[model samples]
Target: MATGKTDLGNAFEDFKLGQRLAHATPRTVTAGDVALYNALYGPRFSLFSSDEFARGCGLETAPVDPLIAFHLVFGKTVPDISLNAVANLGYAEGRFLAPLHPGDTLSAASEVIGLKENSNGRTGVVYVRTTGVNQRGVAVLSYVRWVMVRKRDPAAAVGEQSVPTLAPAVPAADLAPPPGLDFRKYDFALAGAPHAYEDYAVGEKIDHVDGMVVEEAEAQMATRLWQNTAKVHFNQFERAQDPSGRRLVYGGVVISTAKALSFNGLQNAGLVLAINGGRHVSPYFAGGTVFAWSQVLDKAELGGPGGAIGALRLRLVATVDRPCADFPDKDEAGAYAPGVILDLDYWAAVPKRG
Candidate 1:
């Protein structure tokens, strides 16, 4: 029994530049997966909710939420990449390349892209590009993320640093249109909002008034459902040593919650095309009510065979206990408020219904 220890995880000393890892446990997405996703996040976008609605717009059936694909792929990388992480730093160059349907099996692999040891000699940031592929080996999702990982030994040598220069945004031309997707017949009433691409101007702010308090059990269950192996989120004893002395809420939980709340105003902007960048501004724990808001940063027309498909650049913000009534963001001097827990920039597909 003393000799039977599992692979704990990779520490900073264990990572080699350009190393590759094929994650385990390919998941076959099912209607049950989609249903559980909806139950956890409460996403109300009609395209994901109604098979008939998706067919009316040209697809045969509703695809699972893109965030589901994102989280599933992200969850796969935890054991190999972030199991020993101090924190997940940021994300870049995320794009959903294809629709993920029920019964499609998803597997993931990652390549180490960058590493820089901290000056304190306690931790280092590891950057990796993760690609999610279906059963046929067709890539469905791709993205880059950096995480702060602890060093097994403080005296370990700092390896070659290869911080990657990631793209600031995904180009409009590169946005992948779902197969046979056309929004020409999109119904604003059924989607829950009448705002089309033309209705939202750049710099427009939307306060998602609703707030949901995350309970400790709810957060743990959600993380477990994703199969994330990050120890800090699961081991109460490991979290006791953390500065906060509490199990931190996963950033994805905040994102899904905020995205669900955004339905009050951005019901039509349901499809997440890409993640340009994101930051967990600060660590938040259970028992705080989360509120959210969004700002339209930019917009472009992605014309498809179905006619005009609109893509909007949105900045989503999430705060703990503080409602985003005024679209709370960075202060005039350029610092997020104490309550702000997340700052995310992404592209969403919106139907042009006029």
Candidate 2:
């Protein structure tokens, strides 16, 4: 019998700029997925919750949370894109074009858009735009992300660097609400907040008044649940070589947890339409408690068949072991605070309740 050979993952030199890859597996989102997502993230967005609430808002049934579809698509790219990644540096120009429901089958593909070699010979940044599609072949979500990956050979020749210019934020006019989604009959009581799109003002801030302590099991389980195959997050032997001596918590986990915490004051700010940009400013690990807060940067009325609608550009900041009652954020030098781990900018649709 032949000996089993372990599959070593891709290296920085292996990627060609503009190369396209079709990721394996078409995952079918189930009711169980919806339930587990709610448990993991605690999103109280009524559009993804009660069917009665959804119908009242003009949806046929409750739709799956946008982040669920996001994590699923992002997870599918791990093996091909970030298997040998040192860090997922950032994300940009993400747009949720359509809604997905339980039982919808989603598949994804990615095309390398840019590459840059780091000064250190052993690392480089790989930029790719990934698109997710339902079984019908309609694009559901798309985003650009760049990751720092290791080189198998430190002396490998550096390729021509090409970093794609990305939009500072998705234009509010381009942000699409789900087709057939109408929030005119939105129920404030069921949504757990009375705030409407008109209720918020530009330059306003809100403290997300809750926190969750990171746990090793939950972090590992969550990353794995999305089929994320990053070695640093799983292989203890490999991660032990890092200076931190700890497996870094996934940034998406921080996003989800922070988004969940935002529910306290942003209960009606559901339906994430676009991710303008995001940065994992610092690493987070188990044993750290995470808190978050949001600032309203801008707001716009969206023309939708669903009656009055609006989108808000919100800055979500997450910190470790630090509460955000005062909205702890950046400094004069544009540096994050001591405990700040994430700085995310995004647009979300809030109902103009009838």
Candidate 3:
């Protein structure tokens, strides 16, 4: 008889509703990680790139990019939650509770919240709520994501489905700025934009006016840097069965790329308050040049009506090899235009010029 020693991660049937999972390998974020992340995505947000600029905004030092912290937490769950995933579907109710700085040790945990078998019987959707925390056990980030996973046996029975009800968006009152964060002393010139919170109005739109090509090497490296173990991102042979015969770029990469490009106009919109909802509309492969545009969905006064901080609800859209000059988006009938790859709705904290 052969002994089972090798660990093949969980399949569809392995997940049970309400089961909690403690992910391994805690990572202490460092300045080096910050530097590498900058190199990878080239985000020019002053709050993340310059400590002096961050100090100007009343933070102790430049905090790690919220998306970086998010990716780190999401990556930790891949080995256990999505090793056999067909695709990551969408995200909802994501909120950044605290800022992560260099030297902060980060870890993650998840609870299986929902499960539903697909009609094909070869796959199922798994919904998990994952939380990342610092060494002191304070929750830094929390969100819900669902993924399609392959089943080990097509005939295995999956019991009744249980999908949790999620809010369409995080309430404005729930947006939290980092402790001691006072944007009254914000520097517009140094931050790359002079626009303040009041300059933007609801329903207004802006074209980011930049394009970035997704290189295969950089995409793979960025994914590995987060310790993401998704096979579709790294294994060419496994992806050979597909028509493209190329590995798929992680959706988070597109989000960061589109965000970096947004710096052209929204430079002072540095702090990400919440990711209410997002979707990866299409698969993005290496070599596609990505472009972006944004529309102001709504706005709110954070801290108080006359406080130094405020928030903007923005709908960020990304398209491949297509300029956002025309604002390519879903039509009245509810369908995204061609080349449109990502649709992200989130809230960002910006300074008040007062």
Candidate 4:
């Protein structure tokens, strides 16, 4: 697996508890980026896709998609955090503090917080808290991600390790919207939903059964936009030399797609409470078709003078290499067979029935 490049193949070996990896790449979020994302996903939010609407809201222009901020930060960790990953376990304490305007530059860094040896002895867990900062040194986004990494040797010199327990779920009250967010005037029509706070049930689950074929151009465009400089995800030369023989799609794209697909059932769920857990079950490549389905896991009540609302915990699954009409299940070993791309769990805010 030597590529005659930097010893990135062994980058996981150098990951130490409390070490930080910072990646700064300059980028001007562009109108083209917004347009393409809207077109591909059918996100009709005028505030994000229309400059006039954004200006009316007292903004200079349409802001970059908030999820794009997550992409920018998590994508920077592939080389150092999860290069030898067996799985991505979960996320905690994710927040978007500021909006990303088009002309602003962004950078990302991660601090290793926890590490553990698997009882199986083949893999270990590495947890890191990642942060995204704008050119002005303002923290725009922050989240914790832990991945199961393969050990170089089963019996390598053992080091003192302490594992951290992740929250089973985050409370709805803990979910914070970005500063200056006033969704009271939220345009539901432009946001692609006609139902307000009156629609939806406690146990209802909607399957957003649409499929999209990821193209080489599209994947590369998104990865570069996030400033994810992963060679395997972008370099055709590297892909040709690798055993996979195909370029890998960035995991963030899959996560975003799953979030978008959750819109069918969780359309009214505007704000994300937390990313409880997630997994990229299989390697997704360009030209593969992606389909998704969502299930409601739990619900919470939130009532105040501003009427009433609820938060729905949801599990979204994305599949590739096959369709998802049957709702496939995982094996005993926790491995998703062929045709599965992702399994994600999260919570979102939905209005409750009066």
Q: Candidate 4: give the clashing pairs.
A: none
For model 1, the superposed segments whose C-alpha errors exceed 4 Å read 1-4, 240-245
List, residue by residue over 170-236, the lDDT tens digit for candidate 2: 9998898887777677789988989998899999988888998878888888898899989878887
RMSD of 1: 1.5
lDDT of 3 by residue, 1-354 (tens): 555986577889999999999998898998988888889888999899888988887888988999989989999999999888878888999999999999999999999999989889999999999999999999999999999899999998887689889999999999888888888778899988899998999999899998999898999999999998888788876542247677888889999999999998899896898999999998898888999999999999896334889999999999999899976488888998889989999999988887
lDDT of 3 at 168: 94
TM-score of each predicted structure versus truth: 0.97, 0.96, 0.97, 0.78
Which stretches of model 3 miss by more than 4 angstroms?
1-3, 239-242, 304-306
State, as a TM-score between 0 and 1, how close model 1 is to the true structure.
0.97
**lDDT, model 3, position 122:** 92
From the highest lDDT down, the ranking of the candidates is: 3, 1, 2, 4
- Model 2, which residues run further than 4 Å from truth? 1-6, 240-244
Candidate 4 residue spans exceeding 4 A from truth: 1-10, 26-28, 39-42, 51-62, 83-90, 117-124, 148-158, 234-244, 264-273, 299-311, 321-326, 330-338, 349-354
Task: Work out candidate 3's RMSD over C-alphas.
Answer: 1.7
Residues 67-162 of candidate 4 have per-residue lDDT tens digits of 766776676666667766655666766766678876776778888888888888877888888888888999887788887777788877546576
